[model samples]
Target chain A: MSLPLIKRERIFAAVLIIPCILFITVFAFYPIGYSFYLSLHRIILSLPEIGQPFVGLENYRALLHDKVAMHSLINTFLFVFISTFFELLFGLVIALVINRQFKGRGFVRAAVLIPWAIPTVVSSQMWRFIFNDKYGLFNFILFGTDVSSYKAWLAEPVFAFLAIIITDVWKTSCFAALLILAGLQTIPDELYEAARIDGASAWQQFRKITLPLLKPALLVALLFRTMDAFRVFDLVFVMTQGGPADSTNVLQFYGYKKIFTEGLMGYGSTISVLVFLISFAVAMLYIRFIGTKLFKETA
Target chain B: MNRLAFYIVTTLVIFFSLLPFLWFVDTSLKTEIEVTAIPPVLLPSGTLHFYRSSIENYNLLHYVKNSIIVAGSVTVITISISIFTGYAVARLRLKYKGLIMGALLMVSMFPQISIAGPVWRILQSLGWLNSYQGLILPYVTLTLPLGVWIMASFFKELPSELEDSAKIDGCSHTQTLFKIMVPLAAPGVFTAAILVFIYAWNEFFFALLIMTQQEFQTLPVGIALFQGQYTLPWGEIAAASTVATIPLVLLVLLFQRRIVRGLSAGAIKG
Candidate 1:
């Protein structure tokens, strides 16, 4: 190949990758940069004629004192951490069950994915009905003995929080199972056979062999689920709309309400920027700290 | 695990996972009276009235049509762009593979909330709001990372010698990709298509924000905001939900293995 051919090859490579980079830059990175710009100005859409004036850090300052904003951030963190834990637990259980040789295992695996595959908005609606005061299934299952015993699952603060958590675990735990199952399949059968030959109990074998090897999958699952759970907008938007005194007001939903309903564009953008920062920080932490080490060990 | 124990756990897992959907399906089949019954009608009533009304009266097909258009465009565009980019990153000795991959991953994790405000404004200013291009542009971008990861994994696994032979034959990079690589990467394309289709079909955030007009609403937004004030319209909602889920269920059943492979491909490798 001539020098011209080499130059053409490099150009071809650059051309190949440009569309992907360009689309993301415009639609992804540009919006982010624009949001940051809007965040620094008081640009309320409802009062647009007032003009967007530069108000450095005022939105962030207000966030510090706004109890609702504080509450939403705390709620978001709790939702992410708690749901991730349950998702990991349930995912492991299903992974273990599916890993073993069983009749109709494939069917079960596909069935479990149905929940995860269903649109979150639709699934959240289903759960809303399931948690409804009058005709809810969970109400019947729990307090069916007496009609008076039915507690409005989505009405009260504590039960509403539990409802959101339960809905999340139901929806996402299968994703955890899928990732963990992939990990489980990669484990050499000989390790389990050797452990069995060594008279290791089931629990012992799991602890000594499966757990360590499953760490990479578990970490990946955690990374995906935690980020996803933190941005729980559709679920809350459908099921509760961050209502009943804003008990379930997650950061994303709160930002959404401000931007859309109240038309506080700049303040809402500020909230969104914070969400971006928090999730970005988490991604960096995963890549720099856990992602590197895990990939190295797995490699 | 023992046989009995396995059976028990599997049953529980299935029950826990599927009960919500089953309940939704049941409600979709019921009368309006049965839907709001105090104790709830546990058994599915054998009727298609709600389905009929949902489609005919509520114009559910219009939304479904909108969904197909937006999601189809998004999938085609995302797949086309990702194929070349994935090839470059995985095969063409891109000098900044780590940086490119990392940036794509970060884009994947980019918070939709963070961009919601500016995205809306941009679309509005472009006069693209309530238009198909508006939704497709962002959906394609937001979903690019996933498609790239899916394609790149498949590209990485293909033997390098094949590319060398193509190069030896004086085939240009695009020619090689079109004539040689695409045929081999059909399975990856199929997998990426399925995953991206599911996402674009179900995405509510941008769908709600961008496609404000009723004619352009997707299935998720249409069903979510289906009923107006004073009435819940649970049956119509359920019917719409069930109809929306059918294609996904069929896809899962037919391509169960591919779905799993596509989902956990790169993540599991780590």
Candidate 2:
């Protein structure tokens, strides 16, 4: 009770931090460990009589040869790569447009954020309705009075996949733009003035100055978008439900189907574990590229 | 680009961003006949018929109430816990501060599915499934990283001399935090609360898996699973969607600056 003030303060700090650590350890870290352990066992929810039995690496081996799992993995990658590409492209354009001082810039920025602020479920449903065959905005604009030419866009494999990507890009491009805008704000006007004095055109100045300076923000946006795209479940669950012949199925949805719908608990854990490892690996790579100095700055 | 071209492109970007949601809003106001026209109607008659039906028949209020309870509880609890943690890391002389912050960054990056299975089992063992506490506990844990990071940044910005003078004046660590630092960090607390509330309200994956009962489901889950005997109820779904999104839209319009600052803080600082 009579300890030095420094020791007392340190003890108090430890007490303050313990609760936060406890919540994460119990809920987040524990669950990840449990998921890994479950992946090594064989448990079927419906058939409890079989009991849980550890079969080391068997589920992992099975996942290696599982055709549907393989297909969904491919779909997940395709979704991540394509959607983030468009997200970055569109995000850059929006950031550049709204970056400048203009009339009603706040209004325009708020308008741009509306799609992002709306829940993924609501936006997914909106897109679903928009691509409706008989009476949808997409068809109404395309076919107009030519009712015979209207098609059920979501029923086709290619279009359904495309629709989900389009929905994601629309919703998240604003988020990417916001990050890029933060980066744009950091660039000095003096650099542009110097470039102009040296006779650099607008495009030349952009290429030489803006693009190079924007790399870190662009990478951060890409990292966030990539991770989110891999975890896409609400869109698939709401729109297509893994769909016209499982074409729209992604990794998380497939895992949900395996565990929740099909009751293959152990197998589903394997899929989820794979997801965690992939995300962890990608995050590591991005962190390295962005450098640990970023964390140091925040810390 | 020319002035005219700049204006055109700016207008086009905003229009493209808002069109889908506006179209849904338009559909929500349409008469039943206008909703399903072969060539869809360009304009609505401005009816509230679907909203009435959605409230009465769809039990939209129940889902809204559930969402409010869960999201509100998460925001309050997360912000409270994070205040202490943030002060400890940002103000007090704590060893391993860098490690704790790095660990939190990793937790924030974790995929939900990675933890979904085991967390479900843990809840079931405690027999808390399909309850508000069941959902709120996980949400608090998930949102804590965001809350802590934002709060820490805000706390770090405050002058250390203020806290030191309070300590020299015989104030306890707790008093100095609650009386001095907490008020200064209120904006960060507010930002974190809004973000956490939006996350809990919009979350569908956990809500769908955990809250299977109709009475316990949130708005996103309820709307996602909206059904009818013969066909999908597009009008009612649109009505429910419009209602669910209005608060968030209003939030964006009002606190757009805070929202942007909160979102970009973690990314750009790094």
Candidate 3:
């Protein structure tokens, strides 16, 4: 059916997409390639006298031994795992709640988007103020004695980590909720009605009907949020500056700090490459597992 | 039992979602002294001084104007490009459609942090640093892929008979797209514009990295800088934050239904 215009169509199609191809090549592929090139050479901005020198794989070796890099990798994974998990869990619950026919549902839905719509930097700063040691609302709420002292949330490692997590969960869970709500709406109510006719409990109906039906949407939401959470930088950077002792330094911030603060451009590029690889691997895994399964099932 | 449990849970969820904003508003209305009182006044002592002072001193209007210009220009450029590109990809029966679509999706998912260094260098070389053009150009890249993908899906879902009839009347391809198909796809285009505008408005990292001058900063960056400079000024910070968020909140409220439907449709396909 497609054979008659194969040659002409191919040429036309190639022409149509030339600009996009060029864009991706220069903006996407070039940067990725150049990052690797930059990583091969040591360039320290502070010492102009030292200039640029080819260091082979020494940058990678140094990264392997670098405590800060190792810490950040672990912290990054921890953040991705923890935040994505909670966001999905709470988002699902919220979606299920709002998906039901109820009074004021429209208002609830609109109100829910308030947190998600606020810019990350603005929300991060707001939460930072809320978590302030002395005059902040957090301390005011937990108003208590010495051991439970009013510690500057961003000035303490554990507290800063918790503060970042809380702020992130608050800000982004709405996004997760919104996505999952979309998924929930796709499950026909007739499925639940039929399940109820069979004497299934609400929980059972949800488990069998809603869960199975929501799998694809859930996976899409998970993949999006996971990728986003893994690359989180602005919120943590604004709120804590990866604080007290670099406890909250995720991979992005770690890389930014290296390049900008320390002027270790080559080292930063190496970290950036690792972050790219990790996220790329995760994306591939998601496509292989969830994407394939969802398509196969839908088909 | 289920009804009662649902009501209780719903109330708790609403409270959780609203408490932050409520606290923000409450703080914004209070004087600095009232804000930092020992037990922290939840409600103001009938004062609007903080908000009044914040508006007068912070140059909130300037930041608002900067955000509008950057975000507005980004939306216009993104929508313009995606309109043609999306229509061609969707209707032209173009070969390599799958590859093109996949590349678009991949670009949307690619992390910006990785490209920040090179983007910074490119913008510097072009002498676009600290300029609206620098911000808008990269923002176009940020918004273009998603806009194209979503608008393409929208265009694909639209019936082609209208375009066919217009073409039979001897309209050029560009005219068919612009005059006929575009009117039909206005809703999707508007949805795409809203998403792009919001994304551009809310973006912080690139804005901070590229536009270093105080005057060039957008709302998000401006607010962050405000917090840094006035670390102890919680009431004022809250006032500024509240001011920064009001426009988007109002927009979301006004377009709540369309936004939700658009999000669902866009996500389902893309």
Best by TM-score: 2
TM-score (chain B only), all candidates: 0.96, 0.97, 0.93
DockQ of 2: 0.76
Question: Can you tell me which runs of candidate 3 are displaced by over 4 Å?
Answer: A1-22, A144-149, A292-299, B46-48, B55-57, B227-231
Candidate 1 at residue B188, lDDT? 96
Tens-place lDDT digits, model 1, residues A147-244: 78887778898778878899999999998999999999999999999999999999999999999989888888888998888789888989888877
Relative to the unseen true structure, what is the C-alpha lDDT of residue A22 in candidate 1, on a scale of 0 to 100?
Answer: 94
| lDDT per residue as tens, model 3, A113-183 | 78887888878877887887776778877764332567677888987887888888888787788888887
> Candidate 2, after superposition: displacement of residue A76 in Å?
0.5
The candidate that achieves the highest DockQ relative to the unseen native structure: 2
Model 1 alpha-carbon miss at residue B147, Å:
0.3
Q: Backbone clashes in each candidate structure, one number apiece?
A: 0, 0, 0
Q: For model 3, which pairs clash?
A: none
What is the DockQ of the complex in model 1?
0.65
Clash count (model 2, backbone only):
0
Clashing pairs in 1: none
Spell out the clash pairs found in candidate 2.
none
